[model samples]
Target chain A: MPGTRARRSDAEVVAAVRAAVVEELAEVGLGRLTMDGIGQRAGIAKTSLYRRWDSPQAILLDALQAGFPQEQPTPAPTDDLRSDLIEALRLMIAWLTTPVARATGAILAERARYPELAEAVYTQVFEPKGGRFTGTVLRHYAAAGRIDPDRLTPVVLDIGEALVLKYTLDSGELPDEQTLADIVDQAVLPAADRPH
Target chain B: MPGTRARRSDAEVVAAVRAAVVEELAEVGLGRLTMDGIGQRAGIAKTSLYRRWDSPQAILLDALQAGFPQEQPTPAPTDDLRSDLIEALRLMIAWLTTPVARATGAILAERARYPELAEAVYTQVFEPKGGRFTGTVLRHYAAAGRIDPDRLTPVVLDIGEALVLKYTLDSGELPDEQTLADIVDQAVLPAADRPH
Candidate 1:
């Protein structure tokens, strides 16, 4: 009964650090995020954190990656590019409308000051998943003969990124299922129909 | 030369203060933007500045509004929706790539703390121009019988806002002229084309 409190494991400690970064970012914003604060919040020793991450920026980047969904959504072989694109758009929009979007915004703003953090994010978290998603959608469209194979990747990236950016920056409105459907019908499908 | 350096007029003082705000923002970012800094930089009496604006945010907002483009781009009716949309997108992309974009980003990031500034920007800068651009594009498509008359407004807003947001938030990559042309030919035209 005296030793009832559960001992936190190494993986649990890492998760705590990651969650603490998001909490601190939301509470105090990127301007005030510090490694010391993260250590205190995570209940981990400062030396332990320093050994793991070179700087607060590195910690922040790690936190962001840890927060991302483990299983990336893949577009199914719907054979209809429009439908598949719509579903993909919906998944992206859903992610943006969540707490993840706020954390992302903070990281992006902070990245202006810490170029290494930005590069890490671009290389590790942002680029890989976004690239994979785009590639999958484009390959499907290309295989179905819906879009020119050459333009598939660029078009998917452009349209998908635009949707996410628009909601995040301009309107602050989430692209709902209906909106995604409309975007696919109006923007993606038509673009795919163009002659090479 | 000493005589020429005599006390400035009211308009000159205002201009100096606005310029000081911009310069300070560029140097230290919005986090360090302050009225004291502005007064010192502009060589203006602090009392005079207080009389003009109630707070640093007010002064910054006024300066921002003064610097924003007053007139929206005129959408030329190219007799084709694709051409008109491409021209519009090009202009929008160019605007986002300028210094104004950075200033805008700072303001948006600050808006969570200052709601009044957000409202002012939305009403004065974003809403009016966004409405006009979306309306014009939709009108062009409607006239050509390319799109359903009813769905024109939403489609234009969705696509236009998406493109603008993409440039602002995600990659800062402006959709090139060729991409714009392709978007119009494939997406806009097809979306407008209804079932016969």
Candidate 2:
């Protein structure tokens, strides 16, 4: 029972630290995020936090990844490219509109003031997930002869996510079915499809 | 001499207040933006600011518009829809990458926490400008038979701005000429033109 309690308390401390990082990011933004503030907010010992993470950025990285768990693999495409794109975008929309994404957006919003952090996020957080997802889906379409090689660039791959991101950021809502469908049929498919 | 001095002082106050608003929004974001903070930062009386604008939101709207002045009209489409679309998208990139846009993006990044403010920005600022530009250009293309009537919808019209917005928000840079051209040629123009 003593051993179980010790392990349980440690697990709670981890969760608290993760939540505090996200909460602090939302409150003060990346420019002002600090280890002292995070420790105070999480009610954890500063030394213990320092023992685990090297910097506030490191804590933030773990918090974000923890908030959006990577245990679930991105869904693979089936036969239909259109359906696959729709499904992929739907999952993207779900993730981008989550509490974690919104909190991360708050920090990223200050990118002009904190370019290093922004770049870290791009390289460490966003690009890895978004890029991998885009690459996987685009390659699937390309392999099936549905998309041209020239059309497989980053900008084209970003079309669906970009549109959905804008709409979600603006409206604070994942777009309705009609809007998502239009993005897939009108924008994504056409951009990726081989031009006649 | 007295009249001239009065006008000059008023102009300075306006400039200071506007600059302060932009700076505050950049530093603390919309959630923490307050008149007291802005007044102290701008070196103006809080009462003076309150007299001109009803709320911090009003100050922000005025500041954003001031920072990204709207003197130049969005260019109308010429006979060549492709060239016209290119020109329009170029202007959008310019505006979307301005400091005002970046500050606005910072506030918008917290939309989940401040939905009412987000809606105000959408209705009062973004939609008004983005909608007008989209409508004016799309109508021109549609009337000239360059674009299909059905393609005159909002989503299709928004593809260029949406793409540019995402790129600007992500990289804090206006997309390069090639990226803009691709959106026009590969995405916007093709989407608008008669479907095969």
Per-residue lDDT over B1-196 for candidate 2, one digit per residue giving the tens place of the 0 to 100 score: 3344334387888888888888888888777889998998988779989889988888888877665423222344326666667777776667665777777776676677777776676677765554534455667667766667887666777778788877777778778988888877777776677466
Q: Choose the strongest candidate by TM-score.
A: 2
| Cα-lDDT of candidate 2 | 0.73
* TM-score (chain A only) of candidate 2: 0.80
The TM-score of candidate 1 is 0.70
lDDT of 2 by residue, A1-196 (tens): 3344344377788889989988888888777889998998997768989999989989998877666523122344436676667777767767775668877776677787778877877777766554533456677657767677777776777778778876765566779888888987887777778465
How do all models score by TM-score? Answer: 0.70, 0.74
Identify the CAPRI category of the predicted complex in candidate 1. acceptable
Q: Which residue pairs clash in candidate 2? A: none
> Which ranges in model 1 have alpha carbons more than 4 Å from their true place?
A1-5, A24-37, A46-59, A70-86, A97-100, A132-135, A144-148, A193-196, B1-66, B70-86, B97-101, B130-151, B158-161, B172-196
Candidate 1 local Cα displacement, residue B26, angstroms:
6.2
